[model samples]
Target: MELDRSGRVLAALSVAPALAMAGWLMAGLPLLLLGRFAPLPMLLLGVPAAALLCWAGTRQAGKVVEATVWQVAGVVAVAAASAVFNGVMHSEQLIVRRDPATYAQYAAWIAGHGGLPISVQPEAFGGADPWLLFEGVGFYGVDGGVAPQFMPGAPMMFALGHWLGVPFAVPAVLGGLAVLTVAGVVARLAGARWAVLAALTFAVSMPILYTSRTTFSEIPSLILLFGGLALAHDALGRPGWGRGLLAGLVFGLAVLVRVDGLRDVLPVLAFAGLLIAMRRSSRSTGSARPYGALGLPLAAGLVAGAGLGMLAAYLLARPYLSYLSSSVRPLLFICGGVLLLTLAGTAAAPMLSRIRLPRWAPAVGAGLVVLLMAALYVRPWLQTVTRDPVTPEDRRTFAMIESIQRANGMPADGRLLYFENSLHWVIWYVGLPVVVLATIAAAVLVRRLLRDGTPFDWLLPLAVIGWTTVTTLLRPEITPDHPWAARRLVPIVIPGLILLAAYALSRLRTRRWWVTAAAVLVVLVPPAVTSIGTAFTPVERGEAAAVEAMCAELPPDASVLVVERVTGDRFTQLVRGMCDRPAAEVKRAGAETAPEAEVRRLIERVRAAGRVPVVLAAAPGQVAPYGPATHVIALVTRQDERSLVDAPNGTWGLGIDVWMAVAR
Candidate 1:
């Protein structure tokens, strides 16, 4: 009985990340709908229900194949050790400056209070005045209330961490689960022997390590995406539709975690269509209808999950959706077109299947992939990607790029995107072995996909990975800094390439054992070496302690008003979320100091409204005129340094100070 249950356990573990996340959504969504979102019920009821569901599905798989018991154990062991290490090294990003802090603040709010549209409590300032800007850097004022700047999926997951009183734990644990799932996918596709190597290579990469130790959306999204691949792979073997539905649900729900997830899963939709068409063709020929039932359920589940994500975005994150309207609108249109074309192809499957293609088609297809890669490789010499500083965000990015350029002793061309060097970015993190192996693997797989038309499982996984990876490399559209810009690659590009590299090495092992060993060393060494500089040294150290001390300085009923520019940008959400006090930053003209008369008027309004008016500034003198200023927070930390010309090498020092005073 013990031996028999091990396989089931491994199979269940393969889908554990997806099952756990889906369960949380299962519990949280209804609560969110009912305006009673809470973490306790999500943890107690949601997770267990998901485990039961996963167990039931595993049992129904009927002799599911998994890695050897020891291989599975090894994967689990690595994941466990990684979780401990990551938790210890996790960064404290409680104050808003970037995506990490934004997600943290959003989750903090959800954990404390279960509702949408976080209220700005305008009455605390005795109604909004021109000087009192309710909108913080990341929290947008929408519909007379404030909403976070990104999709709620990540914050929703992080909320569970918030409830547990260890917000960093979820990312660490999910990251481990991501490793397990990635290994499971490699085991099933490449071979069971490569599972441990895949796990090690994935965990040691800097992108994975960096995102795992912070509250980033990429880790959770990676877990869900790969778990969906594992589930979908299982569905191909099983006779039932349970695994298929779960696979599509998880894949589609990735959008809930990160809005880009919708773009990542487009191939799933296309793959489903292909399956439907193939099944229809098989029916006409009186052949086995392999994925007949599974295909429709997969499509339905995907639509349901993606639809739920969009609905949540529209209702809960309208400001964010509006901001992304340019890209989001086009993606939705593409999805619609893909769905319609798929339906049409399904109807005409028999006719399409009867038509024969040239035998050179598969080879040509493979050649095309190689050619495309070579083109991207040579792009840097031929063209330079740049953009006009049209939007405010674009101008800010220009300034940041200019600063990095000056610091790095490079020419001051802030407009240079350097996106043409994107392939080099992949090589930087994963090494040239991975790039070479992955390219060969992609080409060979494409040839097989076009000719033999079997191994139906690879269709969707490869399509999703290939499509997302190529597109991202073409247009990173980010700060062009190491680790910061690497977030774009971490979600799909890094892991996907690693999976392909494993597949290539596994295939090569039969011909040359030493070749496989040497390749493995080459593939894993660069990423491991790159991670050494800052892996043990945690970023943003002492930030939580400083924020706690600062929070202690303000009264519970205080209306905190920030007077300094940098302090206001960083602490607006921190004060509102962590301190549990109403807070706003006084608005000013570009680079102008806060006007004293206007600030005085704002303080009087707060006092008249029966709330203690607390003024805060980066320096004591800035707040001393209002009342007796008391130094509250003094922090010295290190942040990840910007690196545009090469791989990131070190950290930069960061210092923060806050002084507070209560108006009489």
Candidate 2:
């Protein structure tokens, strides 16, 4: 029977859900069924799943049902293939780098408690307060409020992992699914071949691979970003307030996933704004659609507000809103306004009509207000909390600026160590240049679209550019640090850059060679450097190896005293290993927190315990102020070995190896 166009579309949509479900089940079943008993099962399952998806997606069906079936199958195939590869190999590395100890502890927590509890785990680590901030032991009963650093999407993802009886690596599998879906959607929007290229590029790209494997919020944030872009793209294809609102909803969800998540909202706002601009620009005389002018912003604001409100509600109920005050409030408000304005302006229209510069005067006023707030609120708050002036010498700021300067090849004393080695942690390893290049490419495409209105042109690049802006700006020098910004931003920038390149390439239809070469240069350089670095010199591997070596030396009865400037992962690992047995690391006759004198007293108590004292890491140039009675045992490297010694005095200088007595 020949189906009508609407009938075909219905048929296509109707069959998609089943195909999607089947594909999902097929992709994850191996991991779930084998339960790490056989990695081969996962590899084997991937082949048929992928083949089925490919076959179904490629098949020609006159009706929408057939087309949709093909789409679902293709998406499933890609996702399943990626999942199998990720589940078998990359997930372990991600887990190790991001939260090796946490996963181990989670296993222990499960064993001890027999299951996860509805409330927070009393003994969980990874956040400030054990009971309030951490809901460890994998997935089930995890409260979104527990991990202030992690977006709710990832943990909610992990919760599914717990439900499915999969390892912590399972979240990476889910992330792969999102990545694959994004590529597929992009491909369909562009072309199937283009989709495959994008997927292949994303898969091989170091930044995407690094994020896809980790349990960090970046992957989930990217998923939300993609979801928003896809929704916004669909909304633009057919304009309706409901579609715009739906776009807003996706954007809101993105922010709830991560504050940087608001970046994806830009295209939604921009596209809407462009519509209004087109409408106004089409008019010959003065307009009375001022209320219409507010439509896009109002929608975006309500959506963003809903997201913020949801997060605030979650935080307030959890007593987290108090984390914001005069100093911090200003930053939040500024970030919120900037995010809102960017989204609104992006959607409002490209015209300089009714909603002119003066109406946006409030944003300028808000900018001044933000600056004043930063000066007044942040300065005093920092002084009070830091108990020192916010100067160049301020350790945290000094270390942060130093790291950035170091990456840029500026002079630094290197005397003070960076917190979490965040300087190297982000720029060097995360490979931010990828997004930066993407930004240039996006700008090129945006300008092209401005000079020439190309349908389907504005959506992807605008979304990406918006996302890139958010990613770049949201980084703040604070306690938690903005470590995930690079990865979270990658999804934004890469797609944006690629879309821009696609546009640029389109422009070079007659003269493809030179333009194509330039486009290739744009895409290749950042990721190439990143790829080379990751392959040749993996920081996570080196760091993990050092930490593993340290953990190996912890004797059943021995206590580890970390000194100097070992990374946070190093200390946290030592604690997890020691805590595995009641008295391995911190269990001693006595304990003390901070203060040199109190620590000295604690050292005496360890002497009383009749156990050998071990110092895990000594920061370069830091002396423990130990009395002469304290003797040096063996020096422990951050890698858990005794071969490396502390730097002597300079930034590279290690600390001393000290024990209360040779014999306790």
Off by over 4 Å in 2: 1-82, 91-150, 188-190, 238-245, 263-332, 335-394, 397-411, 414-467, 470-485, 507-529, 532-664
My TM-score estimates for the predictions, one after another, are: 0.96, 0.53
Q: Clashes per prediction?
A: 0, 30
Q: How far out, in Å, is residue 63 in model 2?
A: 15
lDDT agreement of model 2 with the native? 0.40
Residue-level lDDT for 319 in candidate 1: 83
What's the lDDT for all of these models? 0.83, 0.40
For model 2, residues 618-661, the per-residue Cα lDDT tens digits are 33222335422333223322211111111011112122232332
Worst 10 residues of 1 by lDDT: 56-65
